[model samples]
Target: MKKLTSLLLAFCLTLASFAQQAFEVMTKKPTPGSTIVIEYMPRNTVLQGKKDFEATAYLLEGGLPRAVEVPLKQEGGIFRGSVKTADSTRAVFFAFAKDEIRDNNNDEGYYTALYDKKGEEVPGAHAALASAFGNFGGIWGLKRNQQKGAELNKKEFANTASQKKFATEYASYLSQSKDAADQDALRKLLTERLKNEKISEADLTQTRFFYQNALKDKAMADSVAALLKSRYPAAAQQTELVAQWNKAKTLPEREEVYQKFAAVSSPANELAKNRLEFFDQVIAGMYADSGNYEAAKKYLARIENKQARANALNSIAWKLSGEGINKQPKDAKAGLDFSKQSLALVDEEKKAMKNKPAYLTAKQYQRNLDNTHNMYADTYATLLYHKGDYEQAYAVEKAAVEGFKRKDASMNEAFTALTEKTKGAKAAQAELEKFMEEGKYTPAMKEQLQRLYIANGGTQAQWTSYISNLEEAAYNKFKAELAKQMINVPAPQFALKDLDGKEVSLASLKGKIVVVDFWATWCGPCRASFPGMQTAVNKYKNNPDVAFLFIDTWENDSNRVQKVTDFVAQNKYSFHVLYDDAKSKEGNDFVVVENFKVEGIPTKFVIDRNNNIRFKAVGFDGTADELATELTAMIDMVNAEGGDVKKGF
Candidate 1:
């Protein structure tokens, strides 16, 4: 019994030792500006812990610090890596990352434990939490920490952590602190570091950090800007000028800032005058939005350049002829005056721009001037109808549509058709451009987007590549919103066969909300959406008031029906299937494609009980749960609405 007890005690000690095993780090700045070796030991999760881990050596190369990954090997008990420091290196910082380590108890995701110069963990709020740092205790392990193992004594580690190689603590504080005085002190500390420092690109960026954070503390920002100007005069001036422009309340203050900016950036302040004229154009819009047409016109009159004045007037007139600011009713008569004035200026300016220097007279300026004239003409026609002058309105509106169509055939054919439909100009010039300022994409713009998509084989990457990062996200969001505005149009009726060879019509599916999914047998993304769609289907499956039609369109096979049947059976998908055989082999002239303009496959349409297409989605965004939620929302929307005949997408 005593022998067993002794063995049990030994086992308990071993277990206790294993439980305490955690990461350790030790650093030595061996030979100045030569090499710094870092030794680490991490906790073992399985019978064998991680084989190796990555140590990111934040070493200074030519006074600029950059992170370079150094792979460490485990031998005996510790992980070690010796990396060469760059020339003129002053300090070093180290961190463990992308390690193949896992905890059996928790997988809180990737948490970085930052360490200072002394090899002590510089703990953050996340590190203090038991949920995150439970595994990161200390360097001791089941193996007695030996050579190649970190020789960093606890006393040395504790003392050196206060002074770091990097300005991480200062950077963190500068970003987070709201107190102006505290921020000022930190900036002063950082500035002292910059005095003798030969500035790198990173250092230059950090030096300009004050202006980046200037939106919060304008007074401190001004002080910092003053300091920055002493060092970087041009950059500081430009930054301060923009700040002043954004902050200016009165028009004169804005003009003053604009003049100063223009003087420095453009010789002889030519850009300033043009910018001021543009400013007047924008301010006029603000007045119109406030329902003060007279005030808006007064602002427009401030624009000195004839073309700029006309551009402003054209914008104001468009607002007056249609739904005014915030979709409020417009004043057609008031709009007509501005429209007439703008058209006259447009013609005059066209001749004037030709004589001006090429730089001043850009191609875009000409296009904008011409587009403004076209838009103003619509406003003029709209005003005539409002005053009961239908004959003149019709003649003017028809002429405008024909003029643009002659130049660009793809310039929204719907708008041209709508224009021609006006019985003498009973005022229905509700073109696509009237709503969107820049969103009113012309033929060239639309063709550019289309050709890019076609080149990429109908993938979203092409669309993303065409726009900037910020614009890509915003444009996609805008496009998604546009797709949702279905105009309550009637769902185009179609007769198609099901898997069992029974024919079905949209007419037959009356008194139910029908979900029409245009998919193909081979479309991978379409197939990926099925699981999530199935979850939604299961929810509404028992509800007799809802029906789903999984239309197999744009199928690669000549025998699409057979392929669809095989796929659906193989997956055991409980979906209401329909076959839409393409009239041609290229799959260009299918009924769904031809009638509803389904250019891309995996298009979805939600129809209400009244047979109106209420919602449409063009692609299968990869998220089953999100798709289910959207489907549920669409189903609920139609279900909640009382059965009434509404406007028809």
Candidate 2:
């Protein structure tokens, strides 16, 4: 009886141990060139209650990390997946995700080391895992620890040869180190290796970039470049040819440079091939600019990549159609020709695509094709509308709107206009009303609808009441969707100097609703988002409890402050621009962005009165009014909420 009780207890303990783990590795003692099977039970973690999950295995082989997505299959309550490793794989790290929510095993991640023939762990397995965790972990939703990663790198790459072999990774490690002495030691080691070792051209190029960009040592970088040029003259000449081509102003000069470049550039070089294609597009644009549509078409024909060719044609067409540029009848005619050509190219490409790429599923591929076709169709239709051919424009635009189900605001506005011309104002008004109710209509669409309503003998009071009802319904719908995306996280404390050198800190605005925007002068998307941000700022400027901080970060120019000031002045923006000049423990600039764990620029955070981040917006893809409306909704929600919200991770 005693033996039986002990056996039962042991069995229960074993089962409990298995249940405690979020994931289990089915493959025992995984080695190089082997398959690893894993079972994930998402009873806990962020992926809890989620039906679909994907496992991404990060395999480090030959000093490079490769991410392989393993499709998970549901088996009872758990998900099962497997991945194959290469013979040179040192380690395999796993991260699980269901859409945006990720399970990174509490940010430590789940991983296994590959073993050698004798069943011992590989020498640099931990080093590979460390690099994967620190460098590329954020891409898979795992938090990065640069200091810890640097320690592991220093421990593994003790010898100069190993450091030279993995020069890029080694340099990244050194840059992360806080200790100046450690950097000096590694720099000396690499200097000695450069003198003694017969390094490859690739390594030399990486080393040169590290010295120039990372270390800010122009002299050392120039010396390395000289060595690379002397060792590989063809590569050096190709680089020079590209530089000359960029500088060339006249068509004949550019043609001469292109001939020289083509002679030295190898077909096997992907970068060179891409550059050649880009040159062809630029030459085509130049011809289009000079109003030589025939010559432009001939130049565009030289581009081998069909998608690139189509995009080039669309860009030229857009430029000529007087969308943003000055309008001319001749330009509009040429634009119509280019737009037709672009749409035809899209159709041909769709017919030729027999199979989707391995990365995208069949549904995703079809959706992509539909989107591309619709976009080109809209361009064609828009050009026709500019040409005053309303009947033909309506025919092309209908395929994009009705056939492909395109819900874009601009596209729908154009469709409504065409509808008014073809199907009468009543039909257009009904269509606009449906779109407004669905919360898919833009401010421009709203104005057009109002004009039609007034022209159709509707009273001003009736129009106002009708629009107000639609807006309220739309706002409620938008709020419900935004509620699902609401999250509560502690806002990282920061103090930055405003443009006038006054210090503004988050602590100072404790009871106020704060909107923090991270931006830079050089980022195109960041600049594009500012107009909407300004709208939001202007809306809340009168509110004493609201504050907007436009923090400038990640600027590489020496005169970044002056440039930022000049930009604001020229744009006539009334923004409270702040400088993100704080340094990390490693002495790296732009600490605020790092502390916030922001992956990209134009990210905004809405902090509640309690100093908790209630909302985080990553990018702007809509109109200025849309952004303002979204921001207002977030602020109102945060303001209305009571009690301390629990942190969401």
| 380-464: candidate 1 lDDT, tens digit per residue | 7666666656667666666665556433222333233334345312222224223122233333334444443455475566455
What lDDT score goes with residue 235 in model 1?
A: 52
Model 2: lDDT of residue 138: 66
Candidate RMSDs in Å, in order, are 25.1, 6.8
Off by over 4 Å in 2: 1-25, 29-167, 179-185, 233-264, 323-333, 340-369, 387-407, 424-426, 455-457, 582-588, 642-649
The 10 consecutive residues of candidate 2 with the worst lDDT sum are: 10-19
Angstrom error of the Cα, residue 331, model 1: value is: 1.6
